[model samples]
Target chain A: MWKEWPLVAFTIAGQMAVGFFLVAGFPLFLLDGSHAVGTTREEGLAVLAVVLGLLVAAALLSFFHIHHPLRARSSLVNIRTSWLSREIFFELVFIALVAVEIVLVWGVSAASGLSRGVHVAAALAGILFLLSMIRLYMLETLPLWNQAYTPLSFALTALSLGAIAAGFIWGGIFILLSLAFVAAEIVISFLLAPGHGVYRSRPTPSLRPPADVPRYLHPARLASSLAGLSLLGAALIWGRGRAVEGLNGKEWLVAAFALVLAGQLTGRFLFYGLLARPGR
Target chain B: MVTQYGFFFDAAACSGCKACQMACKDRNDLEPGVLWRRVYEVAGGGWEKKGEVWVPSVVAYNVSMACNHCEKPVCGLSCPTKAIWKREDGIVFVDTDACIGCRYCEWACPYTALRFDARTNTVSKCDFCFEAIDAGGAPACVASCPRRALDFGDLAELRKKYGDVRQIFPLPDPSQTEPALVIKPHRDAARAAERAAEVANWEEV
Candidate 1:
């Protein structure tokens, strides 16, 4: 699983970028002219630019997953049939759409209908990108990853991290929402663990005896996430406006983000660890 | 006619010598961890009680497996690059130049036949000794099996020669891939799973 760091980094980073975009844009589109949780045009561009940068970074990291990076051009050759092809294709589409959003936001007001339309489109594309990612892992031969928890866990990863990151910039309310999602994600992660056993959890094929699912790392990941949730919850209860990094965000929020990120990283590594067999 | 190739294994006669595995590795020059053909040592069953007397009823058997070259190859169907494909002879081959080394096919395979070759930086598997087959010779593994446990022919021919019984203990359900394999199971194979038999060697394959 450690050897699959490239994939772990690629997926989480990509999902995080998409999550941020969707969560931040949700209030804007859902409500009629709601800047209540929106940033200024310049700030929007800055945020979009950051999201674009993360998307690019995630794409670049994924190159490390394949042994022959140069041959990757052929990956799109089978999008009609292969979920992996569809995954890469959608990711590229999402990235391109985000770049377009960044440009449109730079050119016009954030409140303009055209910019908003593109923003909504990009968010949908980001979602398709995530759906492709989920399908890519739900292989029939690999029962460990084939369960319902895969989609649940991935959806939570996107929503929890996205909601939390959005809360970091938008408002205290988003933080509370993130707290709920983080708690939910933690539960889904626990259920996804093979040893959780009561569910559809099946042992991955292995040459060795059945594996102990991340003896130390699994608990540590859950602990960090729980701590993040607690801190964020406490911040909503106590801190009104501390002004983190000149932004109307709490310092505790930033700390919680770091802790949550660490938890997600560890959890992803454990996810890869589940692949005991069925080819590799 | 579209000739689909296949393999036949007589598990009743196999002695688990592993020569077929070695022959395949040597022929393919596969890396240390890569195996085009593997022999799973399925052993299970325990003592049986017969009217207050204990009888040792252990079941053990060897199953030599390679690419079954399924009619519906999941690896090919799931390959993002279309790098894995089947010949008219029903032999699945990974295109060296086209494969991007994504290895999604590895996960889709039921038989665990596709192995990542570090040297080529791509997934590879048994070509069914296509060159040898075209020249009217058997695959290295089939030829090397001293116990005369292995055979190969057209899928229909193999099924007709040796009844179409592909599933046995430890082997995945045949419907998953519709693999072109025929097996003559060992007598103990019938009760292997019920008796708690499993592949004794997880490391060797």
Candidate 2:
């Protein structure tokens, strides 16, 4: 049980960081009206600061998941064959790149070429980070995780949340796009679940502990299903009078976020718990 | 000194033709339902009624992705049996003979770039067409990209040519793992933020 805790902690921390970043960061990057709340500089910095903080926390937490955290440097040796090594390398680079971007944003305005370069670098770094994360699962060879959409869904979740965060910050037409992407992500993740046809692959012995047979639903799985439903419902009511009239839209977004967080947590739980030990 | 070989995807010119996907299949002799590379069309942002015209600007970005052959790969780190390893030139490859089919690497990776060949019960991905590269040729996918959207060379050279433009959107939550591919998005950073806000509002509703 203790052995699994590292995985559990890592999963929870990673999911929380991702959730917060998506909900908070997207508005700063994609919203236009956000400038009205505060100066563009202030709002952007707020978003960047949150993103940086969450990333750092997630990185540190990832170490706990490793059996030998001290030898973490050695993991980078196989950049050619392993996605984990690349994931770590890219994450370190992202830290440095985001730092540089923050500096550029402060030293130079949003319009400056330096800031732009940093943004691009950050974006590229983000791609690497996401790919590495997905590859980590792909390398597992678990039938449930070996789907084509695994990585796509992982990346899409981040993109969706980030877009939503940006909508909050900018408060322009971006809100609609962010909502749409969230809806799409809802559909994608649900489809990626184990029972789905796309994810169907060879089966292995049940990893569930013996004797705890209450239909064993993974927490992440339950959360994901709930999140999907809530997000879809939010989409349906988004353009309605209630949404346009008051804080109804904001309330729905909060609810959707809760569901998303639950789903992410569930995913993390399943990620560590459902290991397919060879010859089991 | 470490040298890594990988592919650069130009989303603007991708055209979504999927020639690279086909070329990869033919060259690698992959079985059906298995793809080394996939092209995804990403559309985002919303429409609003402006003064005279309904200004609806949506960003449609196409991503042609495969294994990034990262500088630090998660697959290798998680493999209990040293089945996956990095080539000297920075290409990651799995030795079928050594792989125990544990699937640890698949779980470690964030990109899902690696696939398990059920026939062999092992994993595989783009080898950078190591055979062709050794014979003074490019990977089949790069060679087949008619739009000139894909290129291969020293990582430094490609970065120089691209000039690392700003506002290129990275995969979400990059802090989780480091990936190597770079991008240059045409959209403005401020604009992206606005879109995010809108989504947040919608979700709240």
Candidate 1: which stretches are off by over 4 Å? A30-37, A194-213, A241-249, A277-280, B48-51
Q: Which one wins on TM-score?
A: 1
By lDDT, the best candidate is 1
Reference-based lDDT, residue A207, model 2: 19
lDDT by residue for model 2 (B104-182), tens: 5654555557766777766766677889988888988899999988887766666777754322332332333454565
Fnat (0 to 1) per candidate: 0.59, 0.05
**What stretches of model 2 exceed 4 Å from their correct place?**
A1-39, A140-143, A171-175, A194-201, A204-248, A278-280, B1-205
Candidate 1 chain B weakest ten by summed lDDT: B193-202
Candidate 2 achieves a global lDDT of 0.58
Cα lDDT of model 1 by residue, A1-280, tens digit: 6878998999888888888887777667554553312556655776687778888999899998898899888889898788888888888888888787777666655677777777777877889999999988887666667778778878888888887777666656677778888998988777656553323244423222243355788789899999999877766655563223333247677888889989998888877766644334
Chain B alone vs. reference chain B, TM-score for every model: 0.97, 0.83
Sorted into a CAPRI-style docking class, model 1 comes out as medium
- For model 1, what share of native contacts is present? 0.59
